[model samples]
Target: MKHLKTPESLLFYMMLIREFELKIAEMFAYGKLAGTMFHLSVGQEATSVGTIAALEEGDFISSHHRGHGHMIALGADIKLMMAEMFGKRTGYCKGKGGSMHIADIELGNLGANGIVGAGIPIATGAAYAVRYRGGKQVVLCPFGDGAVNEGVFHESLNFAALHKLPIVYVIENNQYAMSTSVTKSTSITDLYKRACAYGISGEFVDGMDVEAVLETTKKAVERARRGEGPTLIESRTYRYYGHSRSDPAPYRTKEEEEEWKQRDPIKQYQRKLIERGIITENDVKKMGEEIQKILDEAVKFADESPYPEPSEIFEDIYA
Candidate 1:
């Protein structure tokens, strides 16, 4: 495999995402943060981090509801993200867009959508713009398996293929769409095959493996940048948490959860690093300490930030 990124850097990015997510969960559980709802991708960090790592700065990305990892991986400011979650004035959307609606245009994050499959078309439109402008930038659209059933998924793919838009549709298949299992929802379990209908390349990856995700995404990105049509990548990953904060996810079995836990991306990557002698136990400890310090500061910054004034509610409102 070509090493686009060093193993150590990849492992660090995965750990950063994991730790940031864990911190969010802890804060939310203790009422230290405020939001309408939060969808945690606790077990799906590899897909977000690895894919974003493969993209260049100007490349755009459209995120889904469970998109904290996506924003973090794309270099979103942690403090501002935390502030946004807290509804502070210093947030990316000035406290208006909460956990699900955060957007950083300068960072090329089109925004995270709450509605299923909504971001697909937005990303497709962005890709069209890129092609129209003759820019080499690619747009990466990440959504859940549940989104595959949406009409926009097919429409976006067909349009993208017909126009050869520079975009990559990343399906973060976590097996469950809200409480509905993939088997119960769709007959065609192999999501990549859906791309064949658009006459574009499609493939699957071990989403639990950051290296595999990164490598696969890198290839799709290259194809998109080369003016080839979009690529659909079905990443078979899982989420340790529920669809939302209030979900208990009783639809799944404990045995299955435990099995997936054994393949935890962070732990697996740690083992790989150690086995390859890329990082020692001491190095891991230091890295954890550094991440913890960053999280601590992020929380502090968010806590001290001011809330948006009621008089400013009309600000940034277009309609």
Candidate 2:
């Protein structure tokens, strides 16, 4: 299928992402959201939208703690996502998964994991299953730079390459793994180069450029779909918000944040639309309002929905 490069679609997706994060931040401040807060992939919409656009409907994906963008890009129900965050019975996981664990199997989203590097093996296993079943399904696993420090990360890659599993490992190198800089985490600066030692293909691409990421991921996805083993892609992106609500990002300077903000994915895509004449400034404004309206409706649905009954807790849990 041809990728969506139109200005309207790009602007629409970027606005949807911005509005979603805004609503979540608002809800958090209002005491409507429950559980621990994590890093918000607020500025990284282009990378998610571009790569997801290149995926087939039946293909699988594993998301990290900041997974709302992944879910939204894959067409997960916004109302259900909001409800899950609100801990309501109408949620995707029926209010148990919360933000980090939100999932929709029908959409081919295996599940989002709270633990770093947890999804790597899960996606590797999914890839093995696809190969075993003789299906064309591909599994995409996304994790942060910090996850590379985990043993499972290496183990999963080794297993995937050894067996030629159909999977794509994406590292969103947002500069910092929590408060620690990438410089401090790995001796090898470029995360993608590690793929060579594992005897697999690896590439580092600009995560801020939607077009570049989409084009690169298209090739990687095709390679995996062709039964060629996995590809490790390190998307150099950044998070606008702190590691979590508790962090003010004291480790990084205001100048660094400003430098990244200048390359805002939403703005970059919006400008592309204007330059291409796919959408007007008025169109951008209208898109923003539409997404805000959608978010408002989702918030209302979550607020009005009933919380999970006390008895339901024991039903979803296993011994």
Candidate 3:
């Protein structure tokens, strides 16, 4: 068991993810955010922040549609991220890709995909590139439990391991693939065992615990950087919000939602920080205030930024 070493920096990161997520929620309510949102990382912040922390600056990550947390955790500019959602030219994609398609290649964030499981092959290919160049960079490919059902998931894992590529396939198993729960999707409850078919190591971690996720991911990242091939990690977590903004999550029970909220990774981590003397209530409050100010400025920037001009429509496209 790798014990987590609590540090002040890590506590700050946990707080940032939480504050950013909450700000996004507020933006949605204020009608400031446009486009469809796939919210639900409310209880899964640790899995994102911790895993990203284990990666180096050159390492890459491919995100799911619900990718805001991953991008923020990887040090994406909140202003541009918010601008992209607002369809302003200041977006990472220059206003082309909205919430589902944000990408910052400079930050090693390959991109997020609207199509389910599409990024698996992309991440595998990126890993192959790193291997071909003899670089130590690893790729963290994160998707939901729903992605595992895709044919590309199995094929990509097989190819990644076969070639000894440097990649960590992290399945954010938040219990449900949209409305379908894990119980209704797969017969084998243990998502980790699925890696056996690919002939690689598979580990399960507490997705709600930042320390646990960070420690486990650090090991996997080290192994991959050493050219030990891929590792599949199933992070058992829960999403407090609905699958999308439109979803009421009627299939789930209020009791179930409440139970998961009690296990919220952000709040849990805050308490841990306080308990460890790494941070205090005032520290958390100050962090929250700073994040809100940052986000508020981002919102102002996005609102004031210009939209795409008429001639810009076919610029980035190839016919």
After superposing candidate 3 on the true structure, give the runs of residues whose Cα lies further than 4 Å from its correct spot: 1-6
Model 3, range 1-319, lDDT digits (tens) per residue?
A: 1111345556556666666667667777778776656474777788888888888878999988888878877777889987988888888888888888888888898989988899999999999999899888999999999999999998999999899899999999999999999999998889989999989999999998988998899999999999898999999998877888778889899999898888888788789878988789998888778877887888888989999897888798985
lDDT of 2: 0.86
Ranking by TM-score: 1, 2, 3
lDDT of each: 0.90, 0.86, 0.85
Cα lDDT of model 1 by residue, 4-86, tens digit: 25777777767887888788888888797776488888999899988998899789999889989888887778889889888
Write the residue-wise lDDT of candidate 2 on 278-317 in tens digits.
Answer: 7789988888788878888999999999998899978956
Ranking by lDDT: 1, 2, 3
Candidate 1 residue pairs that clash: none
The runs of at least 3 residues in candidate 1 whose Cα sits more than 4 Å from the true structure, single-residue gaps closed, are 1-4
Clashing pairs in 2: none
Clashing pairs in 3: none
TM-score of 2: 0.96
Q: Which structure among the candidates has the greatest lDDT?
A: 1
